[model samples]
Target: MWLPGNTGVYLPQDDTALLIDAMLLAPIPRGARVLDIGTGSGALARAAADCGAAEVTALDVSWRALAAAFVNTRLSGRRVRLRHGDIRKCLPGRHFDVVLANPPYVPCGRGAPGRHSPARAWDAGPDGRAVLDPLCDRAPGLLSPKGMMLMVHSTLCDPEKTLVRLRDGGLKAAVVARARCPFGPVMSSRADWLERAGLIEPGQRDEELVVIRADRTR
Candidate 1:
């Protein structure tokens, strides 16, 4: 949905929104320092506040998206620190106890999200792991020593590869949950790997989704 001035994109669903639903399920510690990367619609940041996080900060490269997040925060009576920058280079000095991201996991293509999705949000290179890899790589540094991170992925991208990348980056990773729903923004090629990895049992399609959790190791 477009805001009044056409300055940003917005969506309202399940009261909390799509991105928020993913973050709300993350097991955040009470009074924890939290970071919501790619805070589209500001759902994650707002939900973090509702969950009693001691501090909440959200970052998105798009000014319009940031503005929308700010508005949503006020409307919901939730306080959050919002910033705009590339997720990797934006805030080098900030660290959080819990990092939540619902990055655009769809692989790069001419038709998807188009060529101008702020690069950081939907441009994940050939296998759609572009954004995911860097996020996983830098997650260790952005997180406090004992902090944990949670991210959402669809069957479209290489879900197992994402888990591997996170683990390889020194984080303890695991698939926390999975559900089936109508496909949104991924290619059909992802179906095979997901079933082969045991993430989706055989014969499950068109209605399954997955959530992954990774914990930073000391």
Candidate 2:
């Protein structure tokens, strides 16, 4: 919540709130080990801790983001482990009872976000699957048997694609929540390009954000 100026850490937005809502409604088991991937302000991680999870691990690619997360979680009197690194490297053979994600889902144009740009928090490469695809591939392996994952992203990236990827990974996945949201500053700037790319209709200024729940039942 207290991200310092120019930190490039993501601020909690509609997508974050949406995911939290779904997470709160989920059936989190006792002694649940929850993993919050791409945690920005630690909002979701703290929310998971509020669920009385036995342990919460928040992973972020940006140290500044992790710093913000650490501060916020500590302020909430929650014991969330802050890890700095990409999930692909930070987590290997790791599993949790519940997994949460609100990764960058905005479709970017010719110039993708740099490592330090604030847009890095929201810009996914063309088609918006740069982050989502990897996350989907990793979700099944990240969940314990019968564990569940709740992820939120925009329809611009094709929610059905995510569902298929998760299902193919041996998980049952479906969209559980959706909210029509107006374009943000980034999207507004790229509206014309999105139109040209045929990803959105001309003059369409709103997109739907979806929360997908995936279960590893094996």
Residues 1-218, model 1: lDDT tens digits: 22453443534322124445656666577999999888877877888898999999998877778888888888888899998787878788778999888776655544445433544454455466667778888888898988988777665576788888888888899877676665433334555654665545576556434667788778
**lDDT tens per residue, model 2, 17-114:** 88988887885776899999999889999999988899999998887788889988998889999888887766888889999999988887757767
lDDT of 1 at 93: 77
TM-score of each: 0.78, 0.94
Best by TM-score: 2
Predicted structure with the largest lDDT when compared to the true one: 2
* Candidate 1 regions with alpha-carbon error over 4 angstroms: 1-26, 111-123, 185-207
Q: Residue 17: error of model 1 in Å?
A: 6.1
lDDT of each: 0.71, 0.88
